[model samples]
Target: MRDTSTSEIENLIALMAKLPGLGPRSARRAVLHLIRKRALLLTPLADSITEVAATARECLNCGNIGTNDICPICEDNERANGELCVVEDVSDLWAMERAGVFKGRYHVLGGTLSALDAVGPDDLRIPRLLDRVPAEAVTEVILALNATIDGQTTAHYIADQLSGQVRLTSLAQGVPIGGELDYLDEGTISAALRARKEI
Candidate 1:
């Protein structure tokens, strides 16, 4: 980052370092690799980034990132199956889609209710979700928030708000597939037992 490195290269490294999971050392290595493969990787990557920067926008309905006001999932009328899946973020929604399950529509809450962060229901898309329920004639709501403390608190708050309005359900939490009992934590073991089903 001194006499050997140009300011532009240093700047690129700095920007890359700011990305999640990429520290300064990793960013430096990545930048060096990109420079070596400029024609093959850097130019194409830069072009794609520029295109996405100009067109990427959040879906107004579900907070999913897309190039339009309404994301493709929200625009799909066939997805309206009287079932709504509530998730904490766009990443969670994408993860669900990657699994190729859950054919119903989705509602992203943006974030969880957190006392420490002072994030309230209004701060997220909670009100939007509330409006979507009656407006969309939703019969069942599936809470797919993470299992963190704040996530559970947010889920409970949503459940209370929508109580008696529709059939409410939550994603079952427990030990993961192929997990060993010795490696499993106490809470995970307890949840797995509680959520056990008949064979």
Candidate 2:
């Protein structure tokens, strides 16, 4: 019969290699360390992973990842401040939260409208956003999308659609050109949010 232990180790390494920022070599080292610490680390890590996998879900209202259909932020009535921050991804929303500057609600677009990739408005939750503005009594929409070409294009399109219905604003020039909100530090994000201007 084939040796099962080596095959299991290989499988573990392969799975670990698929994680972001981890390659085959790092995966190998990680697997080895986990094996060495089976009781202290591996068992606990596996249990935590299983629990999170079983409970994790996307928020239906804002697209935030959490342990329930609606994330805590979305369910919290205190966050409904008549303002919504439009972001390109959940990571950007998290970054804004980390900065703790914006107390309003959020809308995650999932991605920008990209002509090269053929991504369109219908593909990025734009219609859902439009529906939410009136439904939620949103008075202002702050475009916190990345500064990429597609990001700018998506922002302009949203602004045009919502013009005269509500106030539209975008992060100021302090956000470096082409800088994704996920990459910026909390302080920089706070500064950008504070300096936001009319789009």
Candidate 3:
């Protein structure tokens, strides 16, 4: 016969394993740690996760995830620097925010255009980004996309659309081959942003 409490802990481990970068071993270790430090970590983490699950939403204008229709970044008037940084997803946007380099606005594109996957301009937030350019008085569009082929293809397509509309640029060297922006360190991201080259 199975112990119900043990099964419950195993279920928690299974759920944690589904998260990115966590394997069965790591999940088991994490679950043990959480159980041991329930008051210090597990309880607060569970509460926070519940709160985010209930309140997390996407910003209508930029596709940024937040607790409101308009994210705090979008609502901040000072971030209207006429420079919009375009990223592949909310994770990349958060990475940029963590770096704390660019003081401009952001436009989360959701994901890159993938021909093989049948993803197109309409699939992402490209159209909304286009609308934002002129409406927000944007003078520059920084393609802070990943170093992957799909990311570059999407960036080029966006650059073509906004060629005459605004200045176009992409992160310079330092980003490794096929690297996702979400995995890069803060200093690396800051360097890339500062050394950005026109695309």
Candidate 4:
């Protein structure tokens, strides 16, 4: 490693550089900025990161990230609308929530089925989803997975498994091919959710 005057600050920058979308250059700049605003930004940010690292956990029922075993949406009785929207990741679930179109519950799959990655239905929360369907008294299952090949494959697998049990639907045309839900705007997500078609 390169020698630095402040090894602790250098270590912090090195760690930050490993975060998604942030490179070494950006991490250095961020570290300098944080140093400049130590009182207003750095201290609070460090505290927040520590708090989250200590408390962050996946919801046992739906896989949503929160501080509790069950997520807020899963715990809320008002969200038990007999509908479940399945997404490939937590970010997609958050995006859907941002849209505020579906007042129902959500199930995060963690990732899509990928033969290349050796991921299968059992690898995901597919079995948990099935168990929750009857347990939660769900009437519909909306596949809000991405438009990628793996996403479609996973959707079909779920559809087949829950064939006659509940109404299966998917997001409408607004979601472009290969577009991840996290990148979509709130309006686009809302429109797609509103216009979801039976699959």
Off by over 4 Å in 1: 1-5
Query: Model 3: clashing residue pairs?
Result: none
Full ranking by TM-score = 1, 4, 2, 3
lDDT of 1 at 196: 91
* Candidate 2 per-residue C-alpha lDDT over 119-196 given as tens digits, one digit per residue, 9 for 90 to 100: 989998899899999999999999999977789899999999999999999977577789999998887789788888
Off by over 4 Å in 4: 1-5, 175-199
What Cα-based lDDT does every candidate model obtain?
Answer: 0.94, 0.91, 0.94, 0.94
lDDT of 1 by residue, 1-199 (tens): 3756688899999999999999999999999999999999999999999999999998998899999999998899999899999999999999999998899999999999999999999999999999999999999999999989999999999999999999999988888889999999999999899989999
Model 2, residue pairs in steric clash: none
Query: How would you order the candidates by lDDT, starting with the best?
Result: 4, 1, 3, 2
Clash count for candidate 4 is 0
**TM-scores across all candidates?**
0.95, 0.85, 0.83, 0.86
Candidate 1 Cα deviation (angstroms), residue 109 = 1.0
Model 4 lDDT on a 0 to 1 scale: 0.94
Per-residue lDDT tens digits for candidate 3, residues 1-199, read 5778589899999999999999999999999999999999999999999999999999998989999999999999999999999999999999999989999999999999999999999999999999999999999999999978899899999999999989999877676779889999987788778877899
Give lDDT tens digits, candidate 4, residues 1-199: 5566679988999999999999999999999999999999999999999999999999999999999999999999999999999999999999999988999999999999999999988999999999999999999999999977899899999999999999999987577779899999887788789878899
